[model samples]
Target: MLEGHALGVHGEGVSIAPVDFSLARGGRLTLLGETGSGKSLIAQAIMGTLPSGLAASGELTIEGQAYAAAEGATRRALWGRRLALLPQEPWHALDPTMASGAQVAESHRYLRGLGRRRAREAARRDLVGLGLGLADAEGSLPGELSGGMAQRVAFAAASAGGAPLVIADEPTKGLDAPRRDAVVRLLAATPQRGGALLTITHDIEVARRLGGEVILLRRGRVVERGPAERLLSAPRSDYAKRLLEAEPSRWPAPPPPPATCGEPVVEARGLAKWRGGRALFRDLALSLRPGEIVGVVGPSGCGKSTLGDLLLGLTGTDAGEVKRAAGHRLAFQKLYQDPPAAFSPHWSLARLLDDLVRRHRLDRTAIAPLMTRLGLDRELLARRPGEISGGELQRFAILRVLLMEPRFLFADEPTSRLDPITQRDTLALLVELARERHCAVMLVSHDPALIERLCDRRLVLGQGEAVLAPESLDAQAV
Candidate 1:
């Protein structure tokens, strides 16, 4: 059994209040809250890696081991064997300089005392068992792998430790429907494999799928705890009710119809990309009419985000011509999945947007309105990208693009980093702006619930080609 008794932690000028929760043998618990509610701090505290300047007073026990009583080396030794953690961002968890296989194999040596060859072989086998190809991926680095692939690799490594206590923090953040299901199913089976799981997430749907028990955290406090089904169907607490009500999946009405009588703002004929004898998105043709929102859904590494780059002229296409409507903005507005890496750290928010505005020669007077529409306050504009949350940067990126007033927009997993309330508001803002400007909106997302809310038509991609459905999206409500 894994348990946290009267856990309390704090840093210089920052306070982390005392919290209490527990997970029994083979039990599951989901920690839900808005960003910065101390979900991650709890995970780190259990893992014995609380950052410096942070003091902790807590009783964390795992099976027969007294985790709170152990010192530095003794605690470190227990990590991969007694307690394991799957962090939110796989890239941050992985060492980019090392090969994927080597990174995973290291855990085997540390936990099981296995030889190098045997450890790598074991890691390779686990990767294959997780539906990932071992031969091609084993030799690759995290930078070479896609977002979904990296997450899978990280999960594979974390699970390979075979720890009694497993902590997964938003394990399926950027994954698609099927991949997300696969990852969760894999983690759910961990209990039967003799591991207890503590999942930190804001997604109730994911929590329901990994059902065991639920613990709701709001503003650094435990507001509710019970069976997931009971809590989801009829929440007992007001905090839980507000959290569920704000979910975009619970929308009351369908989205408004796409604007009509508009020319195609962006068109691509036979778009293609080939590398290392692998062809991605061959003969991919797409036409985006002004004021229409086209949703792009596909598995990981299937070239959906790559298509976004081609649309923006960021990547070179092997064969095909892309044409835009006349007088269309030279630079397309885009919100990348990793917004922090997309910009320089030295530049403040204002400097970055101002430079882009000047470079694009966009309307200077629209700045205030643009920021206001994206729900950005004056204080945030003065902060650096490093100082803000992922959701804030994502919204700020959209605001920057809106300043250019591009005739066409491409957003790649824009809502993946945002919580439920912000996701709903952002979707609504995107819809309103597209209609008002008569811009073509190409939304690439893996969330079915999101596609149902914003898109007018669906474009599903598989086997390296996009398949367009003729049926209008008004009827695709769940």
Candidate 2:
């Protein structure tokens, strides 16, 4: 259904090397790579959505319709009818002002040619099929929904017309295990309906679940291509082998028990949070002790991030109290899940970082070494947040928070956008810094393996309450 020959994309003076591939009807192909490996660029090139000044080259054909670089009506006709895209960032893909259900209904109306009333009905059904409730899903706006919900809405919009080929860019990016499985099943079942699937992701596990062929890209070049099982088990390229080896794992030797934890630096008692008249959680209690890593984990939309916000005092609690040790209010720092949101769109990275450094009275010489350790280029400092990749932005966000040398740090899914190697490195750095500074770390994540490996203790939040799990219980939960 889709074919590309010598496909390449270029902006200014840089370009990804040309690549060739084909996906037959009902076929599945996964594109795997590290950040800036050109996987998304290739997908965008296929979808004919390359950013301005970045031109696509070579030939692309969708359903036997050929074009050098499809444009105008040729591209428009192919997009919604024959081909659909699940963007990497659902927030950007969705219309913020539109109701979630309305956006999906619009897709059904335009792509499937359904009447307004029928489209609304279909949209509700689609949302339900994706594990959302009809009443809640229909009433919520895109901004009101969580990351996982927004992704489902985007999926509903993309699949509404039953297009023959779908290109999904990190479809399971922010999802927890169960929701990730749902996406895997949704994409895997598409082939049975005569549609091909092309997935671009940093997750090898996702690729494994939707088994088919694997294409590994490195530095914008196709380094390896083969059956998913064979290549993953025994990759021919060293780079591919390293990528596979970076999957999270239990420590070979358990990390040295943390040094005697200090007194509680921040504590929350009888906390309650309500959104839109719905109680997200109540009577939640947790404490962070200096030099200890406390993990807050639960399924998506269970108020894990909300808990982070409450601790940071960014949001008001409906009821309850949050207490910080005397003189420590300014010592609280947060590493946000959505890195872009934490940064100013109008400011360059250099400006933002410099301002933070000034506020904290930090040594100016410390910046470069920190950036280098996080695998970020010194040159990136001059670029705006939007000008960098998500992985780069995530690293910058981590650096910004660490520079504060806070008494307590709240990290909300800090490495969610990173590749496996980068994730491991970033996590290690966070832990190392926490130990060195004797900082209390509150890590909020949906990643079981991560929580198991890094946290000294864990609080599992679900069904409107938080339960402190024993170490033995935590081991079995993963």
Candidate 3:
């Protein structure tokens, strides 16, 4: 069994107060809360990554062993062989310069003392088991793989770690529905393999689908504990009730018919594109009118992200004419699907944001309100990129772009790393900005529910082409 009692984790004043909880062996528990309600901190403490200044008191244990009492070497041995953690962003967790297979093999070699050949062989087997195409992806670098693919690589590494306990923090944050389901099933298999899981998530539906026991966390304390179905269906506390109620689909949808006001801010005609041999865009034509938000959705590798890059002129088109309105200030931004590595780990958030502001000659006054809206205070801005949550960094990236006051914006999975409430807040802010500034926003996402909520118009991508939703490609001639 795993347990935490009077677990006060603090630096200066207590950041996380006394909290108590328990998880039976082979049981599953989910910790849910807003962006910075101490959820990540608790996970960090469990993984022994908490800082020196911050001390953890009370008791924490795994199986029959007290985790807090374990010696350094004992703890190190326990980490990968007996316990493992899947951090929020797989790409960030992955070694960008190493081959995926090499990285996965290294995990096995280190944890199990397997030789190079044996580890490589085992790595290939695990990758295939994780629903990845081993041949196509084995030699690829982290940057070469899609977000979903990178996440699967991370999963394969964790599985190879041979841990009996797995702590998955936002494991499905950026994954589409299909990938999410695959991960849920993978977690379900852990118990059958004689393992236990602690899934930290903000999405209730995820908790519902992966039904097991749950411990609902708020402000570093457990507020409710019971069967997942019971608690999500009929919560006793107001916090739990609100969390259960805050489904993405529950939010109001964007107004229909898509406000097609003003001139076109982004234009592309007969845009054809390819990477290696895979065609991403084929004879695609689309236009984004000022003051409108357009959503592009498709399965992974269907070119949704490619279209965004094409729109931003980051990728060249094979055969097409693409144009941005004259003197169009982009204030254009893209919160990378995996944002942690988007900046240097050594650089402070303030340094990055300040560089962006000064380089673009943007007004400095805009920083405070944007940071406030994104739930970041002054203190957080001073920390290094590794110090803050992905949600915060994602928001900071967006704010950095907003300060540029671009005439258009290209956001790819902008809210993928955020908690439910912050997801709503960020999307709402984008929608508000589009309407207020008449900025054309091109949002690339795989979430249908979010598309329905934030998009003014929707496009569905297929094999190298995009078809306007509710308006067939056959009717485009009209």
The window of 10 residues in a row where model 2 has the poorest summed lDDT is: 469-478
Best by lDDT: 2
Q: Mind giving the per-residue lDDT tens digits that candidate 2 earns over 1-478?
A: 8888888887744378888888987799999988767788788788877765567889988788887863524576777788889887776688888899999999999999999999999999989888887655777887677677788899888888878899998898778889899888999877768889999989889988887899998777889999899988889999988888777763343475576565788898999987666677888777777888888777767778788778878889999999987654458888877777678878889999889778868878878888888988777777778766677788999988777778888888888788887888888888888888888888877787778778888888776767776434643332
Which stretches of candidate 1 lie above 4 Å from their native place?
A: 9-16, 48-57, 64-75, 246-249, 260-263, 275-278, 325-330, 343-393, 470-478
- Candidate 3's residue-wise lDDT over 59-145, tens digit each? 678788885621223456678887788877786678889999998999999998999999999999988876676655789887887
Residue clash pairs of candidate 2: none
Locate the minimum summed-lDDT window of 10 residues in model 3. Answer: 469-478
For residue 21, model 2's alpha carbon misses the true position, in angstroms, by 0.6
lDDT of 1 at 415: 74
Q: List per-prediction Cα lDDT, in the order shown.
A: 0.76, 0.81, 0.76
Error of 2 at 154 (Å): 2.1
C-alpha root-mean-square deviation, each candidate: 3.9, 2.5, 3.0
**Model 1, total clashes:** 0
